[model samples]
Target chain A: MTPIELRCCGQGGQGVIMTGMVVGKAAAIYEDRHATLVQSFGPEARGSTCSAQVMISDAPVPFPYVRHADILVAFSQSAYDKFVAELKPGATLIYESDLLSLDNRLPQGVVARGIGATRIATEVLGRRIVTNMVMLGFLVKQTGIVSKEAAIEALRTLVPPGTSAFNIKAFETGYQQPPE
Target chain B: MTKREAQPLRTGLHFMNGNEACAEGAIAAGCRFVAGYPITPSTEVVEHLARRFPRIGGMFIQMEDEIASSICFQGAVWAGHKAMTVTSGPGLSLMMEHIGFAAMTETPSVFINVQRAGPSTGLPTAAAQGDIMQVRWGSHGDYAIIALCPSSPQECFDLTIEAFNLAERYRCPTFLMMDETVGHMMGKVRIPDAADLTVEPRRNTTRAPGDYQPYATYDGSDVPEMTRAGDGHAIHVTGLTHNEKGYPDMSFAVHDALVRRLQRKVHTHTSELFRLEADGLDDADVVVVAFGITAGIAAYAVTQARALGRRVGLLRLITLWPFDEARIRTLTANARAVIVAEMNLGQVCLQVSRAVQGRIPVHHIGNPGGPVIEPEEILAAIEGAAT
Candidate 1:
């Protein structure tokens, strides 16, 4: 009964879809965990609003979705609004500072944290959507559902041959962010 | 958060998708030619082999559409080579006519449909367990379908091998009812060495190649080995009703004998082809029955329910068609209630209702829009049955 319900939310152009795929795949292939990755798309695949969910567990994970999340990652203000209600009282919520607004009250039971993901993306990594991978970095730091080495290996296999350097750097920048 | 860890490593693993594993499995099972189209979820089945074929001296052809994709392979199969084609729901629709033709022609071929959302375009990337009945009934007239459904990536790899074997052994078209989740989802697929696999070759029944009739029935098996064009076998195959001698027949004798043999080859030999799973039935009050991705979830629900002092068990279907009627009859004999869940709107539920003959009430849970059914929801259904 591992924490198998994972919901990831981000606006258009963010790599929310990729994050869900990596997490779902890592849970299933690397961890030998049962996993289901589900995503909804907008007008355009790359630049439209999108969200993804991954269910991972040692036991067979039923269905491909969750009524409540064990973990939630939001990269924008809209993401928080759309996904906040799905959180259980004690679930973990990670939000990016530059693109996210923390003013909204979380449900009485959930834990909320601010991760400066977009700032790190634009300043440290010099990109925006890499914020999605940065959120993944923090997720692994928070849950350890997948080892950094395993994620990297999954990235190597998932990402094309040439883009690994930029992705690895973006991921590490988020990995080192101080937990709030 | 600590490094997410689990039980000790199982050592051997290949980080691959179900479609890729299917192709590798086909290769391992000695399939030499593949024809398929690029339909979402199913596209990977051809994609993996497309890259693998030429490298290993096999043939991979991306046909114009699923109709050609399926029919083309029948010719390859007739050429005395093992062949297969993969597609999703809509493509399978295009293939039904040809599938029946293959049945009438007695050409051995395998059709792998990674089922998607139904009656139309449906969901492109979503997972649904529909198409159970469509695969059984879409093709016209009375014929038999030997269908196998795999629950995991490893099974996806292994069952593709089984699909080919059954195709050749029965000399009828076989099917792999793969759905989206299992097709594209990556998992720990163990690639067993090729040498370790037991492969079957195409059965050949040619009597000097000059006087060979393609539709002759072999004793006991009721299926005649197929001989192809230019082998001088004068192979005659048409979708129209034909007699054992490969000629048209509307007379009762040929019609009755030909149709019965097609059904008998599968139903009479059901034990040799059908596969299923049963748990908690030894002394259970409520049982969860599911197939494809839903089976994985139901398995977990059984564990949770049993831990909560509930008598819950699971029955997972690995072979979808040729309905395992005997197993269903025994499992439902003393059960308090049975819940059958799939991704579609009660296709298999109809089959289950017929099998039990209304002895027990069968509840239905379906998501027609390509969504996976949740475990907690299934758990509730199991609990609901108890009270």
Candidate 2:
């Protein structure tokens, strides 16, 4: 199978890099595949544009960065506007519904899905910081590029001490969201 | 004189960044002291060592500056410890004088330069292969140094160990030349068991104190056996022209012999020091030469060119210094042309040209530094070379 390329973009501190790390770890450590993650590094502080690129394959990933993403994940309006055009045709574009008002303009054969990740984290998980967890769960549900068990195993190994339970719960809630 | 029990190495598959893996490699290779000032891209290496040293039996000092950090590790080496310092381009510039100091004193130590774009602090967080030439010629005077370039997190872990071993074996400064992309990118690295690892033991003198000469080799080898301070041996270490006693002789003959030996110790070992990874070279028309992160990009492009039915191959340089001119000449003898792909405009590319000796056309595909060279860009170069 062709390797799956992904780009996750958002403001710094929104766990954009962490989202990529989780999937990379899941594919590399849990699923016994090759994965490479490269994050954008800059002088930007909290609210600036931050992104992470991840490539997963059965063979070793030669080019570390994603050139044209098979999946584009945007957590804010600016991120969606910036990265949506780079998605391959028939690629999936996932975004946070509450943060973006999509103009409904997408590349050819692109599929768009929006989840209220922030609302779900705040309302269901009682913590807005778990928003990336919600999106990660939904990403696994929609793409199935990485197995759900592998992702949860990655989250359990990577998250801070005593925070895995809450983050996994946030992830499950997003995973169970009905198709709209 | 009681020996401490060996600490267990972290053996197994691990998902980590290149810098973190380098730190683990250092520990596994018996590096117990690190003196470094924090710098971007390379800071995580010392950071990981700082957190790890306390738990194990070692020391990590945040020195006043890169100069202090560089020479400070040399001091640790003299005091009987395997030590190292980590930094990027700008910090590496500050450490040049001490790098010369280590060379002069025959210090067995490792210096890791996770290169960033620079004439001076050009890009702190961006990747570059700009320092390929500097690590060899940065320090003043005519002394040879060993430098290794690693393309992935796994090689980062493995080559860091090899760097330390080369330093120990040759009794000279060795370098792990990493760039921002390989240093920051995360991948899976498998560390082997401690028993399975081959570590070169430090060559210390067994001669009695009164009979021991600090710079004199008992055998025909140019490398002298070493003895740490307070090891019941009278020893002198300095940068000025010195004799077998390591004292300042300040004579032309003494200086010539000392300098020649310093260069010969590593220069004569070129066969053992040079490392190159050849892929699909047996049946290829064009060969791509690259190192560090650019090697990975070039390898991907080679695969693409193969699908297009071009007989292109890859020659990845794992060892940068003691440039493998002989191997490059032999490997590309059958090829139509050689293309050098790197992040810097033209550093190692020139070396390849010199090795090829106008036997075939040599082309370079590079940029000013920072943004990575895409696979498509390298693929285009392969096509150009093939035709």
Candidate 3:
């Protein structure tokens, strides 16, 4: 399989950072590839740009960050505007419509999808934390870099001390919810 | 009695980051104390040592800044303890004055720099080789320093321990120059039982109290035997120019003798100190020289070049400053061409070029920022040399 280079961008309180970790860990431990994760968080933990990169290669990866990415996941308008330029010619972009404006010229040779992640998390899952999981579900559906099962397993391992089932509900809400 | 056998040790495999490995390295090398500031790329080192120090009856502290961090470690070392500090580019720059202090006082210490990209805050959580020149000439005066570069996670763990041992043997502060690739990397690190490692202690000047001269050479190793601060042997410590008596005397005679002794300590002890590796040069007409993470890729390029019927070899530099001049000069002299590849905009490559002169065409692949050089590009340089 051709390796997948992914970049996740959203505000600080979102589980967008966790999305990158789940996919990166799944690619490494489950798919048996060399995986590298690099992350940067903004000044405040509440409402700031938080971004992370995950690179998976069948061979050893030399550099940690990518010049361009094969997939870019943006959960906010600031994020989409910030990193859409970093996507290469044949990249795919998934945006959260509850928070973004998408009127720019869609770059040739790339695909874009907008999903209402907040609606599914608040209405279906009855929690706000599962919103990122809703978006993550679409990512697996689109790329299959990780199975739905493996990504959930990643969440179970990565979440805080006592918050596994809430995250799993978030995942189910995301997996069942559809885009507008 | 060897210290390794003195303690029955247990070893196990664990997935760990580079920072954890460095802390473990210091502990294994008998470093009983650590003081550092909590900075990205280096915070994990402090935390691990802090956790393990209590178990082993050592000390770890999160100090105010790099200056304090540097001095605190030196203070511990002077009190007859193996001490170290971990920092990155800016922090290393801040500690340079004390680095000069360590040089002047002939204090034996170890410093690990988990380097991040920057002139000033370029990227906090990123990798960089921007500190090469700083490591060589950062201190205010003329002194020779020992630096070790490890490319893989395993080497980071091993070389860090070796760095502390070397410092203790020679009573000089050694540098473990690690960039982000190895610093944040996670891999299977097989730590051996304590019996598998050889340990060395600091040279003691207080063998007998009255005869102790802090700066006097015991084995003629250019390194003087050192007495701890409270050994009641009356050791003098200062950053200013000092004589054999360890008092600040501003005489030209004292300054010249002291500076020369510090320089000669690492410089004259060359063969035992320099660390480098040579590959495929036995039948090579061209050579590719690299250091740190770029060295691994360049080696792959050389392998492919040989398969394609070209004589290309690799000279990997694990030591910077003392420059690995002896072996590199010989390796470049035999090859018809030499190419220097690195992450910076030709910093170390310039050093390599100056060392080789015009004995061979030293082609340089310059990358100032982002994206490591591809193997094919290095192979292209090798093929370009062959033509």
Better of 1 and 2 by lDDT: 2
lDDT digits (tens) for residues A1-180 of candidate 1: 664688888876778778877887777666676676656632534665567777777865445565688788887788888788888878888887667776556787777777888777877788775777787788787767678876766666677678888887777766777766
Task: State which candidate, 1 or 3, has the greater lDDT.
Answer: 1
In terms of docking quality, model 2 is: medium
Candidate 1 lDDT score at position B99: 88
Q: Chain A: TM-score in each candidate?
A: 0.90, 0.95, 0.90
lDDT of 2 by residue, B51-119 (tens): 788778888999999999999999899998999999999999999999888899999989999999887
lDDT of 2: 0.89
Between candidates 2 and 3, the TM-score winner: 2
Per-model chain B TM-scores are: 0.93, 0.97, 0.94
Which of the predicted structures, 1 or 3, would earn the higher DockQ when compared with the native? 1
Question: What does candidate 3's lDDT look like per residue over B26-76, in tens digits?
Answer: 877888888888787777888887777776777788899999999999988
TM-score per prediction, in order, is 0.87, 0.96, 0.75
Sort all candidates by DockQ, best to worst: 2, 1, 3
Cα lDDT of model 3 by residue, A1-180, tens digit = 334678989988788877887887666655556666656632533678878777777865545565578888899888888888888888888889878977665567877777888777888777877788878887777767688887887778777868888887777766665655
